[model samples]
Target: MIERPIGRDVVARQRFARLFSLGDRRAPLSWSPGLVLGPDDPELPVSVAPLRSTRSYDSIPATITICPRDNLCYPFDSEDKWVAQEGLVLPPSLVASDSGMFGSGLEAVPVSWNSLHHDDSLAVLDSEPSVIILIDAPQLAQRPGMLAEALLTVRTRFPSSLIWAPGISGPDNCALLTWMGVDLFDLARLRHASSLGVLLTGSGPRKVEETVNEDFGMEAQCTTWVQAISSTRAAIREGTLRELV
Candidate 1:
């Protein structure tokens, strides 16, 4: 097998959309892009938004970071309505609308295949997206080998595509994902854990003590956790994310 590239950073083009594949080999890929507002464009009234854990990721403004998910049809359907209402065009797709309807704004929805034998989505993404990120969810854990097979199948189908995975956090997890060539990841699970009173330190998870503090609530906790994730991203840029995790 050919070795995947390492220590590569992707630069997004002005009109490029970065796609992320979620779930197993049998599951289809789901992707979204990070949208940024142009300087000359009219700026909308900025909302002092509530926390994402409270208001949901879709309601939040497009920032330097992005978080996409696998089982997103449900959320996307509802979120797209707001997108239309807000008159915003998400990244990867050059669309402008008074209303945001998920999938409706895009020329096509991102799809996933069980393997190379079934990959029809690869062609569509290749025809577009300046860069594509492939992630191996299964490879992140030692619990299953089937995940690796599925990722391999996807890789074989899109060899020219730029992908990266496993993500930063765990040793075996990062190794497996990097080995498979997943370049980007969303760290929502860690945030979710923080919201649930779990603390992730250098040694891994430990429950937050009840006596830690009374003033910190869900939103505060999420903020704290997100800041840590931000630091992790910085580390990732420095090529030390895997080591920190």
Candidate 2:
């Protein structure tokens, strides 16, 4: 899943957070450690899609697709080569462990990832894959200490898989999260800001009335996301991401 750059030694990687191409070596990444635009505005190079079937993979879109059905997520290779994911490490929380429609508690305040358990931690250490999605990242971020520890643990476990922490990042925290080794983000927070009648900026989300730029719409949020992502990419290359954060 990683396209190692020319200068990085394998051992040197452990000392610092990593940045690299996400998938398909034939296609080098333009900007990884970047955003995966939300469904509302997907102008960026990568955006998400969804899939489910009692049918064939022939009809699925050739992009990242989230499948909610159990043991049903099978995204084809960029060339439709039918490569399979070994397994997904799903962390279970007692408060919301009922197997529901969206894979667990779709609408619930989650407990800390640490409180979840040793079993899940063990699962992570024992498995290695191309991607690891912290589905409840927004909730986890509320506890900064726990969030950092969770990120470090995942990075140590699967250094190669770019961490995907959805719903937890925007211009406000993008650089910080990137410094923690999260390679992908979604505009869930920005979209929420738009819905709440605000323009999300690097400084933070702003009130529609307070800002001179009246365009507090989705496009405005996309522009903000772009700027944040560009800054993040630049910081990663320049080795100033911690300073940026």
Candidate 2 backbone collisions, by pair? none
Which ten-residue region of model 2 has the weakest summed lDDT?
A: 3-12
lDDT of the structure predicted as candidate 1: 0.32
Point out where model 1 deviates above 4 Å. Answer: 1-117, 121-126, 130-143, 148-197, 200-203, 214-217
Predicted candidate 1 versus true structure: per-residue lDDT over 1-245, tens digit per residue: 21111111232211111223222223423221111112221221111110011112365332111122122232222111111111122322221322232211121112212212233334465333222322223333333554455456545555434343322333123322434444333334444455677655434556766786633244444344334434443444455544543
lDDT of 2 by residue, 105-161 (tens): 111112235333433433434434434666557666765476777778767766665
- Top-scoring candidate (lDDT): 2
**Superposition error at 196 for model 1 (Å):** 4.8
True-vs-predicted CA distance for residue 106, candidate 2, Å: 22
